[model samples]
Target: MIVSKRIAAVAAAVGLAVTGLAGTAAAAPAASTDLRLIAFNDFHGNLQPPAGSSGRVVLSNGTTVDAGGAAYLATHIAQLRGQVKNSLVLSGGDNIGASPLTSALFHDEPTIDFLNQVGVSASVIGNHELDEGYQELLRMQFGGCHPTDGCQFEKPFRGAKFPFVASNITFDNGLPAALPVTIKFVDNVPVAIIGVTLHDLPSVVTPEAIKGLKFGDEVQALNKTSRLLDLAGIRTQVVLMHQGDSTEGGGPDDCRTLPGPARDIATRASASIDVFLTGHSHQQYNCVVTDPAGNPRPLIQGASFGRLLSVVDLKINKRTGDVDRSATVAHNEVVTRTVTPDPTVQALVDKAVTLSGPIANRQVGTITADLTRTASPAGETPLGDVIADAQLAGTQGNQAVIAMTNPGGIRTDLVYATSPAGEGNGVVTYGEAFAVQPFSNIMQTITLTGAQLKNTLEQQWQASGTKFLQISSSLHYSWSQSATQGNRVSNITVNGTPVDPAGAYRVSVNNFLAAGGDGFAELKNGTNLAGGPVDLDAFTAYLTAHPNLAPPASDRVTVLP
Candidate 1:
């Protein structure tokens, strides 16, 4: 009844109803009304418009203007709730974290406030939640770290209003208690939402972050929780899972289709589950999967960064409150920027903007040249070079001798441009730099033999275009792509000519990659490690000390012609 009326409204505004060609007319309402549910996932702190242009979201009647901010999401949630008393709001996971500096700097406090205002009832735990470890998560759920602490700025972080669920994650022997597993009975519907985090949480997050926790099987977790919910007479069951499948769209920022573990688990889920909402991989889709009983269960995920809103309309038998045997409909709606902002939600957005004003407006410095850190022909970029250089510089007199950076660790491209009016100010903001390298990776200095260094270079063969290894001053190596994997590096040098295989060499790298992360096997076996502080700050200090210098473009770590 709501959708039909909505289409009628669209038709009335666009004159589609005048022609009666706006698709099938809504079937007359059955004895029981329809329940509208909304879900979003992987909103990684992109509160701004993901795209440059704004387009009208053609909602029923006179196209209610809407868009992607948490404010707009709140507006949408409010409007939907107005339509159906039984409406539910939920997330697949990764609602924040891995976001722009505006939110990340505050440990994603603004995000929790926005979610609270948007009426999020439940969510799964995403990998990014571990960015600051479980302690920060507690802060997000409760309040800011301290009113006088650096975590607090213009305003204190408003805590989460809803529950965060993660069923399969277990704490360590002496660690603190984790969040609860499931939620039940929203609006007296006897609804049950079971949460499950990704099994590969350790691989994605820093090992130290998950040091005291263990992530268990998603399917098993859901099954156990479902049985518990069923025994409690809760028939309406949904899974809020954080693990995700990939999309055809390349790059971490793009959202495409959904497949992989999320879909597989949904298709094989216990019959008790009516639907599954997924995240983690940042893909988007509305797929209907059949359970073992051949019953169609809906699998859904909204694209990342609040770019889309997934809506599932289900018909429940009034008496049993069970989804009607043949009445489930699913679709994803893009959150276009044209939607009018709901005043209340806009108020929340304004507060966040005001809170972030000082730091958001500050300019840090400028990239003297185009500092890039993506996979390159020389196996490294200016950005990678900058990061490595900073690490070595930070530990100059400390226990560090050489610093190494992982090729994959570099996330964004850095380009410099003059300020408008042709001013010499080509400054980069702390926010901009963070965007270029979002991961809060800690630096480590390891004592490695030259033989081990050669082996580390050889590991690049395991992943093509992974030869990116930036150094502080002088480190040179050449490899032929055609050579045998282990024998690729031919001319290995540090500071000048060939390096002595038996000589000890101090090298720098982030803790993750040094621990054989991303399958870089040689890094794990390296010797004598030191350091646990954020590498970006070190880089900032280096830049502050030398403001006018630019790293020379060298073909040191090169692919032999």
Candidate 2:
């Protein structure tokens, strides 16, 4: 039965007078069993502790503490699991991809090993999982050496022990891409776990990576699978969703004004869903929203990079085989490094770090100061400017006059301080540079008319959100805050020359942007496409070419009030 029908039946039974039943013997209350769920999202293969702001978690008291690292996360999970007799470890997607050098260097096999050792029951497929394409994702699941780079690790690549579930992603033939639902028998009571990613996955990932896959609506796919679980007599349902929302800077468990896709989906989702474990926006919140049947359920997200864990404890009524909504409790816990690190997991981290040390520690260049991704008021960043310059220089052989790079690709800042590897101040290592641009996207130069370039600039203000492209120093443009979306950009120039609408210009961008990823649809219309070196190579080469490199100014794009 659907949730609405079940709710209506209960409503109709309320306030009924039963004089004869009062005289009869009273029945015993239904027995309930406790089931604990330990969940995290967007680990992103940080086997070692992440550095800088990404490694910290804010508390409700407005204080922050250092957190995260695979071994530390393992210790926290073990401690949480021990609190209940029946517990399950779950991930809300992005277990790998966009990882640090140690994990990404070995094709994220070490991270999978960590997840396997820690006993993750299942996970959702995040957008970054499709970074190397679907076939590679399949390889990550079923076990195999990379088709090209065979067996980079000591042993043959073993696949993830946990299943990657996705109800919405389907093949061209209308078959599901992964397991839609996983059933876990907790103390003889069946609990169903369903997973789905954001519906707008195509806009974020490279088009070629998901060539034959179709991403369906998250609510529809979730509801459909939920109904099936209900009919199968499994009423205790949980959703591990890769799409989430944000809140004002709050503590791990604070849920002040939840606003985003996750909240919207929670309200419309089936009441049978006992709890939602969400990610994607990388924000932390613990919220309760009323479902379609007017029942409040927990919707929680732990901060990304293993910095926090979202814990949901459910009381399953053994008689009805359903979760006791009134008894459900959820909160986010910080994965602090105070606990003793799990020795086994730590060993895996040690091995990977040792094997990757040679290439990871190689000095790439020097920086005079930090080149951060923190955007200026006009949306450009010092690191983004440097990346754009690098892309242009790498493609100059193709006569590329201007270059633009997306802010999303600039993952981390290049800090001038000494690193954990003990690299001296102002020194930049190959590993650090790789972490900033881990996608290994190839550079592409294309021909676009000046008019099309303007249209591309106009696309910065998309319906989803504004994504300001970072351009090389040679290109300059100003945008208006009051002007409408398509007409906001003006004063476009290249080397101080006014842009001619009909004139053809050679522009450079990464393959992801060149294929119109991030809603930059105008980039897809370019002609005379020419491919160049990989983005990481371009970045490192540029850094090497310049000594004592200072961060470029973020004043390229003028923002008109």
TM of each candidate vs. truth = 0.74, 0.92
TM-score of 1: 0.74
lDDT of 2 at 46: 92
Q: Can you write out model 1's per-residue Cα lDDT over 56-121, one digit (the tens) per residue?
A: 232323233334666566666676667765576888888777676666666677777777767777
Best by lDDT: 2
Candidate 2: tens digits of C-alpha lDDT, residues 1-561:
123344333223321111110111226543777888999999999998887667889898988899999999999999998888778899999888999999999899999999999888889999999988999999999898988878987468889987888889999898777777776666556677788899999988988889999999999999888776666666888999999886787898889744578899988988889899999888899999999899989989998999999999999887788888899899899999999999999999999988999999999999999888878989998889999999899999999999999887877778888777898999999999998999999999999999999999999997666889989998999999999869999999998999999999999999999989999989999999999999999999999999899988777899997
All models: lDDT?
0.66, 0.87
RMSD of each: 9.8, 6.9
lDDT score, candidate 2, position 20 = 10
Error of 2 at 1 (Å): 25
- Rate residue 15 of model 2 by lDDT: 15
Worst 10 residues of 2 by lDDT: 15-24
lDDT over C-alpha atoms for residue 537 of model 1: 75
The segments of candidate 1 whose C-alpha lies over 4 angstroms from its true place after superposition are 1-33, 49-68, 76-85, 144-158, 173-181, 184-188, 250-259, 324-326, 368-386, 392-403, 406-426, 438-440, 450-503, 515-522, 541-561
| Residue ranges of candidate 2 with Cα displaced over 4 Å | 1-30, 60-63, 256-258
